[model samples]
Target chain A: MKSHVFRPLLVVIGLVVIVLIARFFYVPSDFGSHEKGYMYGWHRKGNEDEWKAFKVKYQFNNEYCKDCHSDKYETLARSPHAVINCENCHGPAMEHPSDPAKLKIDKSREQCLRCHYPLPYPTSGRANIRGVDPEKHNPGVECSMCHNPHKPNLRGMK
Target chain B: MITRRDLLKKFVKTATGVMIPLAAFEIIDPKKLFADKPFKTDEAKVRWVFLVDTYKCVGCGLCVKACKTENEIPYDANVTRTWVERYVVTKNGNIYADTPKGARDGFTTNRIDLGMGKKQDIKKEDIKKAFFVPKLCNQCDNPSCVQVCPVGATYQAPDGVVLVDRKWCIGCGYCIMACPYGVRFFHPKYHVAEKCNFCYHRINKGMKTACVGACPFGARMIGNIKDPGDPVTKILMTERVGVLKEEYGTKPQVYYIGLDKEVR
Candidate 1:
């Protein structure tokens, strides 16, 4: 009777250990759904702090983001947008970074379009109709030429 | 004796199991530091390259100012991303920076962080004129940041362009640590990894970047190395070129034309 009870309990414990081990490796470590919306990059995993570090550290971005997304930081640092925080474009992302791919940060062009297509950016000092002149210029034709991340101006980069 | 391969495998396994986020700082791993593979990169894409012509450069701060204004970058507490660096190599082999003049003319001193990295050496222009070199992203084939990224947020594309996918990014700033050029920056708002995409959006649509379009000196050039007959191809064939910190084996894509060894 004692052996029977011990064996079943041992089997349950073994299964739990196996599950934990599987979670530690095969699982992508990061998970969660970010519903913060584009205004804040709602997800928390891939966040704004990473973006700023990328801009501040490098002279010319050498694609530092690859392997773990050093691309945005690398490109923006060299481009005109290196000044602004990544959250401005991506939105709140505290939930996604820790959980891996739980959030879809760059799934569509909505976040970029908010500023790139003439939206009244709700950020502080950013509500001055500071949006893109989509009618006049093709964002597809070198958006970084005129706009910046820190102070994206429509008058073109002077 | 425990083989090196066994040690490496042990390290990777240990590292993967650890999964702890580290603060941004250069950690010279003994395993990585001792690797003898020169230019032995693990990157999975073609690398982007930049070729800056120091001789043709006109000490204009257009690139610097443009980079700031376009990036919305706040006034520097440290350095400027891309700017023209001017140096004077004299006839007697006395090297000097014709600054105050160069700074006034935007020839150099983008790093407002270090007394603007400025040293005044004004003299007659005829004795030794200043030559400008533009500093920006080298877009190395073997990037330090890529190797250092604990996660796979940063990646290179097949077209040789470096890019970031925000979704997988963790904002760890590891890439910020390993870079020798000091080109990467952190975003204030997103708290995620962001950098130069070669104006990938525009380039994909067949257009040049702002600096390239605004360069009045005809100094900046963008190219597709695949097209052998391109202007960059022609320049590469005839011009003298150099890169920064070659000892790191990063294989920087940015080439300096008419580079002076004494500039460092």
Candidate 2:
């Protein structure tokens, strides 16, 4: 091969090496910085777009959720659970109200495990397990299936 | 046909909608309390509810006194961890609510208005006619507090108990906004959202709630809806019971049997 082609090939090879190295050490899941960026920064949607263009990745406004879900907002405002954010359980609903059809709200048991999955993290505690293994517990069988959120744990409750 | 202006417009339109809240959720996750119960209801065998008959109320403030003594709630704070508000309605469309309230810890005869309370003069005959609404957590079927709990802290149990995981809660103050009945509040010492747990500590051990046991009027009832013969189930089937804030779609478990139509 001519020197011109040979030199260009080496440059491309060198670029590939650099890119690979960056990807390995910089995968977003490891530090979660990239995931945060992907979730929050680079993925910003337009200010006044239609539901058709709305994506689950779109940023949400609590006030917007409070618009339709005002009752939840009022009840939760002073509740003991008030410090917790709505997205932690509902799982990022910015896109939910926009199209609702396309936007996923994490309604499944796996979704509940996002934070509640009783990890060995030592902070969640084994006693906090409430009896079952968070890893093996299936909400489909029970747990949230019968419980009412408005008022909880009354007399003679099973 | 993509005009440069239109293309820019579309691009900009699509950008901002996705950015703001995405950024917000990062910091907000730590603050959520979960209302794990959905906005729907399934028939429960052991549905728990509370009933306070206005006619039975003698304005003695016994329940109020009982609540403060039991919960050790601060009286000076003017926060009823569970207290009664008196209302006096007259024929004139004039209503004077929260009149002559009392408590175990220094409750005044003064008519202190509570929670968007109404103050209107009624006919002299209408005086002392208002009933007591033993206000606390309604424990709705579709409880708004549970709906807004970001962390799933204030969730319903499998057997139909709306309990908060006081341990995992971050106390973001969202459920306070979510509840229409104005039941829950921030505990000053615990610094988390707190309300009537129906005396779970005692009830779990087969004892009744303090308020329930203390009521001399037999106004309150407790039972498992799962049982065919439970009193609450019987009353729900036999008597006309009412729930507070029904218009908001929160199907409260606390049923007011023999509740007056005009009672708020």
For model 2, the docking class works out as incorrect
Each model's number of backbone clashes?
Answer: 102, 83
How is the predicted docking of candidate 1 categorized under the CAPRI scheme?
incorrect
Residues B191-248 of candidate 1 have per-residue lDDT tens digits of 6665665655445445454455435445777776656677776777777777887888
Report how far residue A24 has shifted in candidate 1, in Å. Answer: 10
Once superposed on the true structure, which residue ranges of model 1 sit more than 4 Å away at CA?
Answer: A1-158, B1-48, B75-80, B89-121, B125-129
CA lDDT of each candidate? 0.50, 0.51
RMSD of each: 18.7, 24.7
Q: How closely does chain A match the true chain A in each prediction, as TM-score?
A: 0.28, 0.39
Task: Please give me the total number of clashing residue pairs in predicted model 2.
Answer: 83
Which tens-of-lDDT digit does each residue in B86-128 have in candidate 2? 5555555655555333333212223344546553333335453
lDDT, model 1, position A60: 28
